[model samples]
Target: MIVAILGAGPAGMSCANACLSFGLKPVVIERGDHLGGAQRSNFHPNLWMLGFPGETGEQMTTRLAAHYRELPVTTHYRAEVTRVAASGDGFLLTLAGAEGVRTLSVQAIVLATGTRPRATPALERFAAECPRAIIGPLSDSIRDDIRDTDVLILGGGDNALDHALFLAERGNRAVVCTRARFSARKPFIATCRARGDIELREHCARPELGHGNERVTAAWANEQRAFDWLLVMYGYLPNTDVLAAFDPAIRPALSAGGYLHVDAWQRSGVPGIYAAGDITDTPQPSVPTAMAQGLTAARAAERDLVKS
Candidate 1:
């Protein structure tokens, strides 16, 4: 059976690798130029480590990509899937690119498109003042231009702390402004605090625009404060546009707070369709969890294919 994977991130790559193990033909379509997806070019130099204190996102992506290279899967970079529709016995996919439009038929589909950042009002206002304000996808801010800027980061999650630590190490003055008390794991929080470069401001809300026209010049929590750059690390919202062509009966079963719904085996309501990674409404949307879900979905698909 021919299966089409909608992304090239960890989950999609893992799914393709699993399909190879089961002797199924897997085709991977990635919108980005690189294989790492969101992990590509998202941070300063020498800034690697998870909030739990382990390998970096780049490292994880590299390992996963290497594993995928060893598998029998076809990868198409710079390919964007414009449409997906149910076909007579499978699904029809339409892709658009510089090379022109291409269509393919597959017996099964795996939606691992993942999630993008949710933009907050604070970030919107900040961007107006300092054109350098970065939000959502971290990959856009990996230039040498951010070397000596005063950075204000919002949120208190693992990603927030990770950004703060990373920026601080790069010689940028990093300050964290959290709405609530920081509640990350003990070890991670401790590491953040130990870094003298990071200053924590607890119970502080993002500043509203003040005395600025184009970009955010100053922000006021209780008082006005100035910053050069702002980074928001609140969280991510799922990217589920490709699922719009599926039957409505399957829609509700696969949606939760804008994220896809999945069973323990990572199968969606649609028999031949599956989902994994941050796009799913899973409890923990970590890299490892996404990879595991991808493997599970691939195995379940293999079983169903054999039964047919």
Candidate 2:
């Protein structure tokens, strides 16, 4: 059986490894030039990844890529699936890359495309016109040059509060504003509260952002503040737009938040299609959980193929 995994992130890599173990041919498709997905930009150590203590995300990527290089799985880097259609109990995928366009047939498909930072229309407009605007914390754009500065963060999720702590450690002051109550972890909320450099605000509507010179001015609810940078950490959205390549009837069900809906085995309710990682509506999105889901999806694909 041939399994086509759409992504080169942790989930896709794990799925490919599992497929090889099951004696299935795995073809991994990646839109990026390399693996690890958003993990590539993570400079902080991933405490959630067991057995790899103190290893940063970049280091972990290098280790994973090294092992993956030894595998026989076929890979397409800097490529994407442009189209997909049902083909006799399987799928026909159209791919476009530097080599131009081509097609492939596979018995099963794994959607591990992952997620991206959520954005609002106002934020998008502001970011386009202001150089001090940043979408998320996991960006190289603000990695080194953004120290000892004042930052304005939007959101109250774990990502927002966690990065507030990171910025504080970097000698920067941060002001966090959320539309609703703080939904971040208790530890994060408490830690941020204990810090004098970080200010947390709830029930804040979208701020009016204006830029001048090297700084930005944010006005919200009768309060005006100036910051060196504006970091919007409104959380993530699953990258399920690839599903548009398939007919509506073939597309898997999606949650209200646009994440794929999957079962215990990672099956997408649609036979021959499975999803893993941030693409699915998992309660907790983490590296280990994505890896486990990918492995399970591959095994489930193998079992169903064998039964057929």
Candidate 3:
């Protein structure tokens, strides 16, 4: 049975690998010019992925990408899955990419659409004016340009601290300001506390921004503080937009945080459809979960196709 995987992250790649393992044809669609999803730009090292010792998130993903290319999988890079719908005994997908607008039907679908950075009013208001002035958890987007630049990052999560460390390591003055105390891992919190270039601030009501050609001329903390860029790590929002076009009757379940509600095997409870990775409802998001979910979902879908 032909299956469509809508992503190229660990989960999506894992799904493709498993599908190939079971002699199932798989098509992978990725909207980005590159594969690997958010992991590509994450600066922190991933400790879970076996065999690749001390590999950072991006490095791990790089290896996975190379492995994926070697497998028997059809790939559509720069392709967007604009729409999705349930067909007779399968699913129909609309795409807008190198082939323009076209649709394909598949026996099963695995949504590893991953996640997008949560938008904030402060960043949105000036995003277009200063595209380089701000970035999200994918901190590398502005790392090269931000060297020796004063940058303010907002958030209290582990990724927030990760960004702070990343920026400081790159010679940028990193200031992490949060509205409340940190909710990150203990080690991350301790590291941030011990940092020199990175300064941690708490109890901030919210960042008050002043306009500049590069997004912010000043931010109000106790006084007027200016920075070249405002990096925000407010958290992530799932990219399940393709599901919106699905029939209402068969729409996949969503969690309070907007991730898909998948079973242990990664079924979306909407036969022929499944979810994995950051898009799934898990208390904490991780790379291992994404890969395992993809493997499990693909295996389960293989069984379903056989039974059919």
Candidate 4:
């Protein structure tokens, strides 16, 4: 059986490896030239990857990439799956890549496209207009470029609080605003609260934007303040828009929040289609969880195919 894994992240890689263990051919299709997915941008140490303590995401990727290269799976980098359609108990994927367009048929499909930072039209406009406006989780470039500055962050999630703490540690003052009470981990919330350089505001909406003396001016809560940078870390949204390219009649189910819907076995609503990693509606998403789910999905697909 041939399985199509859409991504080169931990989940997709794990899934491909598991498929090989079951004597199945696996093809990994990646949108970028690199393998780590979003992990490449994460500069912080990943505490969740057991036995690899203190290893940053980049280091982890190095290990993963090295191991993955030793596998027999077919890999396609800088590729996009332009279309997917149902075949005889399988699916055909149309891929566009550096080598031009091609098609592949697989018995099962695993979606590990992952998630991206949530954004609004206004935020997009601000990011395009202001060089200092940053979005999404902290990256290596952001860390190196910003220091000892005033930052206004929007969100109440773990990411927002973590960014605040990190910036404060670097002597930057952070003002974090959210539309509701924080949903971040208690430890992050507590530490941020104890910090003198971090200001946490609840029930705060998005601010009106302006510019003053090369700084971004944020007006909200009946006050106006200018900051060196605006960080819009409004959490993540699953990258499921690719489903729209599929034939609507064969599309898998998605949650109201736009995440893929999967069962305990990692099976999707449509037959021969499965999902794992941040693309699925997992309650607590993490690196370990993604890898585990990937293995589960691959195993389930193998079992189902064998039985059929």
Q: What is the C-alpha RMSD of each candidate to the true structure, in Å?
A: 3.7, 1.4, 2.1, 1.6
lDDT of candidate 1 over 198-231, digit per residue (tens): 8888888667744333224445645666666677
Which wins on lDDT, candidate 1 or candidate 3? 3
Task: Encode model 3's per-residue lDDT on 1-308: one tens digit a residue.
Answer: 99999899988999999998887898999988888888897657786677767788878878888988899888888898777777888988888998789898999999999988886665776665665455466556555666787778888898788877877888888788888898888898898789788888887766566656654655464678778777778888899887776778778989877789988889999888888898998766788889888999889898888766
Clashing pairs in 2: none
Each model's number of backbone clashes? 4, 0, 0, 0
Report the CA-based lDDT of candidate 2 relative to the real structure. 0.90
Rank candidates, lDDT, best first.
Answer: 2, 4, 3, 1
Per-residue C-alpha lDDT of model 2 across residues 1-308, encoded as one tens digit per residue: 89999999999999999999998999999998988887888888886898999998888888887898899989999988989999987999999997799999999999999998888988988899998898876486556777899999999998899889988988999999999999998989999999999999898888888999889999877889899988899888899889989877788999887899999999999999999999999997888888999999999998989777
Pairs that collide in candidate 3 are none
Ranking by TM-score: 2, 4, 3, 1
RMSD of 2: 1.4
Report the alpha-carbon TM-score of model 4 versus the true structure. 0.95
lDDT of 3 at 239: 92
Model 4 bad stretches (over 4 Å): none
Return the TM-score for candidate 1, rounded to 2 decimals: 0.84
TM-score top scorer: 2
> Candidate 3 has what TM-score?
0.92
lDDT of each: 0.74, 0.90, 0.82, 0.89
Q: Choose 1 or 2, whichever is better by TM-score.
A: 2
Provide TM-scores for the models.
0.84, 0.96, 0.92, 0.95
Determine which window of 10 residues in candidate 4 has minimal summed lDDT.
137-146
The CA lDDT at 230 in model 4 is: 87
